[model samples]
Target: MKKFNYQELVDSEQALQKRSIFWDPAIYEEELKQIFNRCWLFLGHESQLPQPGDFIRTYMGEDDVIVVRGKDKVIRAFLNACTHRGNKVCQAEGGNTRSFTCSYHGWSFNTEGELAGVPLEKEIYDNLPRERFGLVPVARLDSYKGLLFGCFSESAPSLIDYLGDIAWYIDVVTDSAQGGLEVVGAPYKTEIPGNWKLPVENAIGDGYHVAWAHAGAMSVVGAIGNGRSDNVLGINANNTGVDQSGAIEIVMNTHTVLTTLDGQSGYALYDHPEPVLAHLERNRPNVIEKLGELRGRQLYGSETHIGVFPNVQIIQGLNFIRIIHPKGPGKFEVWTYAMCERGMPDATKEIIHDHVRQTFGPAGLLEGDDGDFVEAITHSAAGYATRQMQGFLGMGMGRKAPWDGPGEASPGLVNEACQRGFYNQWRRTMEADNAYGVIGQTAPVTPVTAVLKEFRHG
Candidate 1:
């Protein structure tokens, strides 16, 4: 693949050349090399593989992988391809298994990915060195707060370093619950007829579209997405009836966070029961003392929308985490997981599940709107005239200002600052010769310091 200068495609902080990058197969091919192949992609959470031999089928880019808990109680991942004939070795999504045997040739591999049994062994051909034919493991694997992430490139930075300041913000949910978080049920998986990047941009706190695209669904969930909020982004208090102003829009590295400062608790949107509210309320002082006044207040109320660069998007108020996988230039799949406090009652979990399903799953009322919108964008780009034009993203340009806050603080939820940040990082990664080179280099336009690095918000 030719090394396309992503900087030229991105133009500047305020503008982006949309058509060539969004719909071109050539661009996607290069992205597979520079971005997907080099980054630390999230695989499965530790909670998903609780016991020895438990495993789950997941993807890193388009490559199928089997993540398993070994007999030694260590987690590992291997390419799900047989050493012979390139046949898929595992088909099931997840279950406990002592070994995975290729259905085609009957070659078996143990949980540690060592070649165990071969159909012919010493009979058909001189017993080949079995040790040399074990399942091919990924280059590197690591975890942060129980979230498993694997990197195909050995040169990639450490998982925590790659996460950067975004880790500090994500811990609000990952570290908040008493026993940490877990995937409650099977993921809601489905294909979206749109470029994978579109969804990533949306989840990076795309407050601009929520009020318009999901206006109807917002009414059903709560008044949160209605225009009653103090800002155009409709990020007011959960009880939308009350009038309040002030919203926090923060862009850190490739991550984006949107929070409403309206005094009402974010729990109101979920209709959270009093006990749920009290639990967080009881622990509020600790988080407050840890994160200081502003961030602590924001963390206390579940009123933030966050997206960790490349793929993972989390909505604290909605209690949902989604991982976007690129299937092709114009198609992608989203794996949705419902999250709740570990010790919550069954009834409470059920309620949380229902809410998450109704709001963000494949058939989710609000999610349906976003799918249609992004798909429309993809379809429109097919026309020759549309493909020749450049797209505008100058929302709140020249408005970003350094604040004493945690990340790159900016005002106005409707701004495209996060989109710029996303493309900027994309350019950096694509420009680098290797993944480790991506460290210490963000959008060149600004310098990032974790001012609150020592603050343990949760």
Candidate 2:
């Protein structure tokens, strides 16, 4: 937990992170304390629990929690553990329930998390105080456009502030349409023997991996990864026969956006692009009028791969929201949910869900295409000498963000700008004493220091 360990673990000037960060148990424990506990970790979308008594079990860094809709119509979360003997109060992933009863002792808690009933109460105790035994609540719970996030630290800033200017980009998908986004079907869950940060970095717009790693899926999916936004990352667009002219790649702090500018829609890989394209075209004018021409017209159907710092990610067009849950230093769970505009036809929703499953689910086509290295890098670090080496994120260094978004925006998806931003925030979080030291201290984040926060000149 020493400051020097963090400094060495992530040396930005060298544009590298120690291989050990993906393997060490001790460093993982520190991350739970410094990063997971304080940040506003996404829990579940409100659409998942609509009725009173509806609940779903999810996790916040390894801490299991129950997110329920109260009879009073408010959403809240509490530790899944019963206050009695620490046994889980509920086991079902989700369902409508009058109350959660501990399977072992029969202690029960109501939706608001009050200790509503205790079996054999009169005989078991001499006036035991029921209120003292309620399910322990998460420190802070809040929502942003129906997405739920919970924080264990009381001093953390409001959810909107934590999102920063990233909200504007998020609005392209969430707020642009008449009705905001919602999870369409039950989330697809799978466990990967990979470090949590690996996936986080990948989704932080690792557009570089899309071409080589997912080559098999490329041809079938219209080669969307063939550098369509701005000419194959550096390779000429003409070489691939995919015209990249007029398409714009918008880089935001910790995110990468690709707009198939001038009426071109983004989800090229879907089975029937006509349905998706029609939907986008139908809504184009309305969104443009609401969110402005630049954000609405360009991004409404654009391919937006956004990683909301730490671990939540959203793919706007193919449309799935991902929550990367940390199981341990070398293992994590991928919870994938399809996101679609609430106003869309049920058939369109079905299309988005099917495509999300085929592309990003556990046994997905592209999953195999890109997962080998993710598994390899983590397990490789078990070797002592191997773990000592540092990994670099130096691609696209020294590039200034000509456009205003947030954080430093490097030019293309091939750039490791988001990865560097990921580690810089990780470094600042590990080095800070509390939540206030990192997020919300500033608005829209004053761009990183003159030389990238971690990429120091001296």
Candidate 3:
């Protein structure tokens, strides 16, 4: 009747136990404290809260939160629930408001989270403890390049240290243009019946599925590969060289990046106009100067995929960002955003947004295909016997060799190195007794000396 120990459930260096990790309610509860509470989870972007009084309602773990820009032009998040009866104070998803009023009662709180209004100040209770009932604020909040993040634990690491080498990779997309990037419009919000980790793992470094799981979708978009052999499965048929030596997969702590380095050939799937394409070319010097020559060549006009630790995924080539909000052990809310270059032409922005919506948005066929598989895994893993077995992550374990670059680089684009790295970090955090100890550690250093021969950047 007892299951394996938590250590046995997640042998992230090799494999992970399929069932208990995915279906156990106890482990999920532990995740809330050890993982979500301690980590810097993504909140809304600064672009969304550009003006004072602007606000957007989002979540940190299962807790409801409202990110608001106060009159002082400072962004802060408070618990969305009113302190009086625990009723929701702000019902609107987002708006510019001076204060939030509870629908259940007349208790009102100002943008700064101060108790400002009460139904009966001196009539019912004679003297009300207004100061004691103010809405609670999140323990810690920080941002990186306009991407806001909040942590429930005060002792959590600074957001920069938390990002580590992955920040450099993110700068490729976030800092590509002179003015940086901005979300085109509201996010495409949808709920899916799947574990939160399912999408995280897939986004990080699951290029293996694109050729197979999305083969039909790719065919519709005329991206199924030019003159490549297409069997009934139509997989591994892309001759675009995106999966060849041009593709590099790097696993950095919990974050992962898969980038194509073979020049402009990587944009074969995109149909942007010449002017739009030239925008990236104009920014080539910025990338080269910010990142070294190696990363510069790899990221410029290249198809890039990124997974930011616990739950943020970005496809730089496609100009979209995905935030996965865990609902429970079996469900999650997927927030997809169309990210456009800040100073780009209006037509370019429209092209980016419309293309993103057609390919990976809520109504996208590619999303539908991914949902089917994600739900299937969660649905079938609930079996009593299946929980006893484990899932394989040994794809490119020993195939990782040192590169003349940053992060842990492996050979194949479809490798499981990133997946293994993800689970390994998850296991360490989930098993730690103290959140401070986990966040206090320095950024993980990949021992390149042990992994490959000495090489120099030309």
Residue runs of model 1 more than 4 Å from their true location after superposition: 224-245, 261-265, 271-275, 289-294, 401-403, 440-458
Per-residue lDDT over 305-394 for candidate 2, one digit per residue giving the tens place of the 0 to 100 score: 666767888777768888899999889998988888888888887887778888888877777665578888999999999999888888
At residue 110, candidate 1 shows an lDDT of 95
**TM-score per candidate, in order?**
0.88, 0.89, 0.89
Q: What is the C-alpha lDDT of each candidate?
A: 0.74, 0.76, 0.75
How many backbone clashes does every candidate have?
0, 0, 0
Q: Considering summed lDDT, which 10 consecutive residues are worst modelled in model 1?
A: 449-458
Q: What is the lDDT of residue 413 in candidate 2?
A: 56
Model 1 per-residue lDDT at 361? 82
What residue pairs clash in candidate 3, if any at all? Answer: none
Candidates sorted by lDDT, best first: 2, 3, 1
